[model samples]
Target: MVSTIVWGTGNIGRAAIRAVAAHPALKLTAVLVNDPAKAGRDAGELAGLGRRLGVAASTDVEAALAAAPRAVVYAASGDLRPAEALADVVRAIRAGAVVVTPSLYALYDRRGAPPEASEPVLAAIEAGGGSLFASGVDPGWANDVLPLLVSGLATTMDAVRCQEIFDYTTYDQPDVVRYLVGMGQPMDYRPPMLAPTVPSMVWGGQIRLMARALGVELDELRESVARRPLDDTVTTAAMGVFESGTQGAVRFEVLGIVGGLPRIVIEHVTRIHPSCAPDWPQPHSGAGSHRVIVEGRPRIEVTVEATDEDGNRAAGGNATAVGRLVGAIDWLVEARPGLYDALDVPLRPAIGRLGRRGV
Candidate 1:
């Protein structure tokens, strides 16, 4: 069995920890936390497992690597500090551990990433003779893997559009709230979109992944952001941290082109406050569903309605993500060393259950 270490203690971290703990092919070795205060706590308790694994949370990277884990699941914080988080993955790879992450910001399109941000990690993985791959549910699945899967049904293709819509109201994580809806802050406090030069880190690689998989070479990419306010003051458990109601909805779209011609359009929406548009698609107003429309000779339109087994809409698409990650771990370990996106990897259905029904 390959011994594995899990990093972080947040939502994805917790889900990954549970996945590692139950995998037959993996041995749970350690849990690493950046916070000094969380050090020495049981990995299981930190993940709400109730049972202890004899492994404690830690901040010392070298010590964790000294334990000689075969692999490390770098499920750390994914935010503006993605480069820093990837630095940790680089260290793990240098120690001879295969690293797999869902950080979502690691150089999806190598050309777009700053050399300072990406080169060191690639160099370390190369020098260590280990492998690294990053992917999340939406970018990993809906845009890349799903589109590739759908392409199998077509004899010829022209354009592909992938849309991911999910309700932000049920998601209670602060970082998630901030990343999706820009909650707890005023519109003026929002960062400026840098146009074609730099798009939001979230979907840059996703757009590129889709384009490359569909055999479309993009010449130009454009991004636009739109927002709407909440009808009234709202409250939730994420309150104080992410004040409810004032800022209700936000949408971000990226259009990819080949020779200045549009080939793909990727759109992301977050609605914490309720609003309606006449053009918005039905069933939660473009929330809680993923639609991929392909225009080609065959003209295939596929709509994947994401819902829990009980039929309630899931939040953040994390279940699908965790399931895919758990299923992909074995393949990721055997993958060649270098940076890779979803389309470069293979994902398949599996019997190893990882996600909790209610969470």
Candidate 2:
């Protein structure tokens, strides 16, 4: 079995723990947590898996990596601390452990990634002869593999649009929703996510990766953004309350233009309250969806609605992201040491372990 360590115990990290434990070929080793209070806890309990895996959580990064884990699932949040996240990933790579993460947004597509972000990671892999793969749901399977697969059926193509339309009220990440996304901030406040060039910085790689898959070069990359304020105060199960006229919803698109038209587009329509943007598209089910629209000969549209154990759609999305990273572990171990993204790594299908119930 491939020995694995789950680094971080946040949203994606907890999901990674469950995925690692359920995979037949992967064994859950030590879990690394930054919180000292969480140290020495059972991995299963931390992940809400209902049983102990015999591996305990630890605060020592070196000690965990010293155990010679074959792969490290780095699930820590990089939205706010990208440099720190990049450093952590490099440290793991340099320790001779294959690292897969959704933390490093810039390295999602190494070819288009900034030199500063990709260079150090490449250096670390070279130093330790370990591989690295980074990806998540939107920047991952939904845009890269899924669209390419659907485009094959088209006799001719017009444009490709990948959309993540979700209500953030149930997402429950206060820091991300209130501050990073500017969900409950004042109207004049600018969320770091929708800031100038930030959308492109985060999702341009996805557009370029799809362009590569389709064998087309984009003429340019562009971004369009719009924000909506709440009409009245609203409360949610997770995020406490959002007041009237605050930045309640945001809609943005990262477009890859070809021939002066948006040929490849990635869109996000996030809302703190469902009533905020009645005009914008919404998920067909509980909270939200990931949609792929191919405007062409066949005109294909695929909408995905996923739910977690608690029936939260956003948590469900996070789980799939964990699956994408953890699923690539064995493949990364076999692959030559280097940085890999969605294009370099193949899509791993869901074949849950035979004896694992409700995986």
Candidate 3:
């Protein structure tokens, strides 16, 4: 069995641990954490699994690697310190462990990254004879891999568009919500005459991945952002934890160009307040849903409708994203040694079934 080490105890880490523990082909050997408070506690308990797995959380990365794990899944916070987090993954790879992470912005656009960002990591993996892959839920799955999968069913194609629209009313992470939806500010707020860069850091690679997959070299890529506040106070079990009036909304549009001309348009909508639907064909009109439209000789559309148990859209999105990552672990291990994006991997739905349930 392949021995695995899971780093982090957050949402994604917990889910990955649970999944790894139950997989028949893999063994959960260790769990690494930065928090000293969590050290020595059972991994299952930290993940709310209720049972004991005999494996405890520890901050000692070297000790975890000494156990000779076959792979390491780094699911730590990416926003606060991505470079540091990526460095940790690189270290694990150099120690003869395959590394997979969801950290780092612009992972698909390696051209835009500084040589210091990925070169060392790639070199270390090669030196240790290992592999590394970085991907996010929306960009990794829906936009890049999913579109490529759907395109296989078509005879010809013209354009591909993927969209993620979710209500952020139940999202409680202040930094993430603020970064994604442009909260804590007025809708009409503007920079002092200088054009501000929209939050393309979240999904810019999704657009670039699609362009590359279609063999379309983009000449230019542009982003536009729109923000608004809730007209009325909205409360939910998850949102109730946060003070009211702190919620806001944002819309992001990414226009992709081929041969100096616009070709693909990708949009993402994140809102913390209730509002009217936009002028487009949405599956649920107002409720949280994601849709992908492929405009070609044979049109194809796929819609994903997900509702949180507590009706928190942001929580549901996070859960789904974690689930997808858990599902990709096995395939990630089997992939070739190199820096890989989501489109570089084969993402068949059944790959998820290979892992344990919660993973």
Candidate 4:
């Protein structure tokens, strides 16, 4: 079993901890946390897994790396503190930990990522002989290989549209929902996340990744956004009340121009409440769903709804991401030292995972 360390205790972190403990080929060695209160807590308890996994959380970053774990799952929030996250991941890589994470947006498609971002990682990988893969549910394999794999079923293919339909009410990141996404903010408020070129900055890499994978030459990247205000004052189960005039829903797209036409599209329909966006796309049956629509002969639509413990779709989404990244630990440990992207990593099968406690 590959020794593994999980960093962070937030949404993705909790899922990562649960995943590592349950993975047959991965042994949970250490868990690192930023919250002092969480430092001494049992890893399973931190993950709300009901039972303890005999691993405790620690805050001593240096000491954890000193153990030289074979793999690291860096699930800290990079949405607000990207530099710190990057540094932490770099430190792990330098310690020779084959790291997999969803925090780094630029690394999602290293081919289109800026040199400044990739340079340090490359240097660290060279120095430590470790590998790194950055991926997640949406910008990760869902849009990249999942779509490509689905497109294989089509005799002819035209445009490939990837979509994320989510109700943000269950999403635990209130800051991301209210501030960054501009939900519960005034109509005139300009959400930093939706500002000019921001969508491209976040999801443009996914577009480029699909292009490179499919051998499609993208002429340019384009973005469009639409938002709606709550017609009536409403309160979410988690977040406080949103006034009628405040932004309650958002729909946006980051498009890749192929042959002067928008061919590859990454679209998001996010609502603070289910009632906010009546006309927009809805999740298949729950809080969230990722979909791929192939426009061609025998047009096809594939939607994935992952429901984790307690039937929470958001938790399920996080769990799926953890499964994807954590399941890759053994492969990463056996591979050459380098940074890998979505297309490079395979959807590893549950070889010995059947009838397991975690599955």
Candidate 5:
């Protein structure tokens, strides 16, 4: 069993803790948290695992790394603190811990990522002789693994579109919902997530990764965005009220054009409420679904719905992202020290550590 430490305590971090505790090949050694309030807290309690796992959360980076964990799941949020998150991951890597995370978005498809963003990671990997892998639900699985697997069944593929259609009311991140995603803001307010070049910077790599898997070079990477205002006031348990005339729904697509045609597309249709978009595609299950549509001879459409313990699709999606990162731990440790993206690693389903008592 590989000794592992979980970093961070946000949505992804909580899920990683649950995963690490349940994995058969992994022994949860320590958890790293930047928040002093969370310091010395039981790992199980932090993860909502019901029973105590004897591991306590620590605020000391050097001390946690000193434990010499074979792997570390760096689950901290990079949305707001990209540089800090990068530094944290590098610190873990330089300490000889194989690191996996969804924090660094640019690392999702590192080939297309800028040198300044990815080079430091490579340097750290070389310095520590430890590997690194970055992945998440949308850029992680929905675009890379799912699309490539679905495309394999198609003898003649014309276009591939991967979509994340979900209602975001269940998600509890207020800053991200209001500021980053433009929720509860005036229609004129442009969220940083949809700002010029940001979508291209975040999702463009996923498109490029898809193209690379199919052995096709994209002529261009294009971005398309559309927003809808709420027709009436809406309320959610997680986020407060969103008044009418404010941004309620958003739909955006990152298209990879080949020979002047969009051959590969990564689309996101997110809304604060289900009633917001009558015409937009709806999730087939409880919350939302990740749909992969291959348009060609014998067109194929596959919809995937995932849920967490309480049946919250948002949390389930986060868990899947955590699983992708943690599941790759064993494979990553065995591989040579380097920066790895979704395309570089096989989607080995980490199963042994699942279904522990009350987990």
Candidate 6:
């Protein structure tokens, strides 16, 4: 069994805990949290599993690493504090633990990743003989794996597009929705996500990944953004009132131009309230989905809708991303130590998980 440590107890961490418990080959060895309030709590309870997992969460990062777990689920939020997140993963890698995370966006495409992000991580892997893979749902599977997988179905292709159609009303991340994404903020309040070149900085790698897989080089990368203000005020159960005229919806794309056209695209249509952008892309029938569209001879379109716990798509998406990460731990344990991208890892199936149950 691969002894694993879950390094965060937030949204992603909650799912990581349950995933580790359910996987036949993974033993839940430790849960590390920076939150003092969460320290010493049972992993299962923190994961909302309705039972104690015996393994308690700890505030001690050093102590957890000292045990030298075979795998580390680095689920800490890297949205704001990316440097610190990279450092944490580096520390874990240098400890000889195979690390998987959704934290490092820059390294999603190792070849296209900036030298600053890729160089240090490579050094860490060389020093410790441990591997690292950075992926999640949007930047994870939907961005690279799902789109590229579907591209194989096309006889001939003109363009490939990946879309995230999500309604964040039920999503509990207010700081992300309000501050980071500028959902309820004024139109002038530009969030870090939509800042010039930031979208390209964040999602441009996925486009390059697809291009590389197709054995073609991108001519250039571009970003386009559009935002809409609410026609009226709205109230959400999770985040309280959002005044009218604030930013309500956003549609943006990171385009990978090949030859002379925008051939590869990653688009997102995110709404704080459904009424804001009636014309923009909506989820198939629910709050969220990852959709792929290939404009080719056959014209293929596929959508992924995932739900977890109480039918929450956001949580479900996170769970699926965790599945991709946790599901690969066993493979990483035996593979040569190095940095890897989604394309380097196979989406292994539930070989022994047919009857698995969480504690």
Number of the top-ranking candidate, with lDDT as the measure = 6
lDDT of each: 0.68, 0.88, 0.68, 0.88, 0.87, 0.90
Q: Which residues of candidate 3, in runs, are more than 4 Å off?
A: 109-113, 184-198, 239-247, 259-261, 276-287, 306-316, 332-336, 349-359
| Model 2 Cα shift for residue 139 (angstroms) | 5.5
Worst 10 residues of 3 by lDDT: 189-198
lDDT of 6: 0.90
Highest TM-score model number: 6
Error of 5 at 76 (Å): 0.5
TM-score of each: 0.84, 0.97, 0.84, 0.98, 0.97, 0.98
Clashes of each: 0, 0, 1, 0, 3, 0
lDDT of 4 at 188: 96
Candidate scoring better on lDDT of 1 and 6? 6
Compared with the true structure, model 5 gives a TM-score of 0.97
List runs of model 6 lying over 4 Å from the truth: none
Q: Could you tell me the TM-score of candidate 4?
A: 0.98
Better of 1 and 2 by TM-score: 2
lDDT of 6 by residue, 281-331 (tens): 888798889999999989999999999978998898899899999999999
Tell me which of candidates 4 and 6 scores higher on lDDT.
Answer: 6
Please write out the lDDT profile of model 4 over residues 1-359, one tens digit for every residue: 89999999888988898888878888999999988988899998999988988989999999999998999999898888888888888989999999999998888887877887799999999999878999854537677888989988999989999998888776778898899999999999999989999889889888888899789899999999999999989877778788898999999999999999999999999998899879899987878898999999989999999887688777787888778898888988888899898878888887787888872
RMSD of each: 3.7, 1.2, 3.7, 1.2, 1.4, 1.0
Location of the lowest summed lDDT over 10 successive residues in candidate 1:
276-285
Instruction: Indicate the residue-level lDDT of 160 in model 5.
Output: 98
Candidate 5 lDDT, tens digit per residue, 18-129?
A: 9887777788999999899999999999998888999989998898898788999998889989999899988888889899988887888878788878888889888888
Point out the higher-scoring one by lDDT: 1 or 4: 4
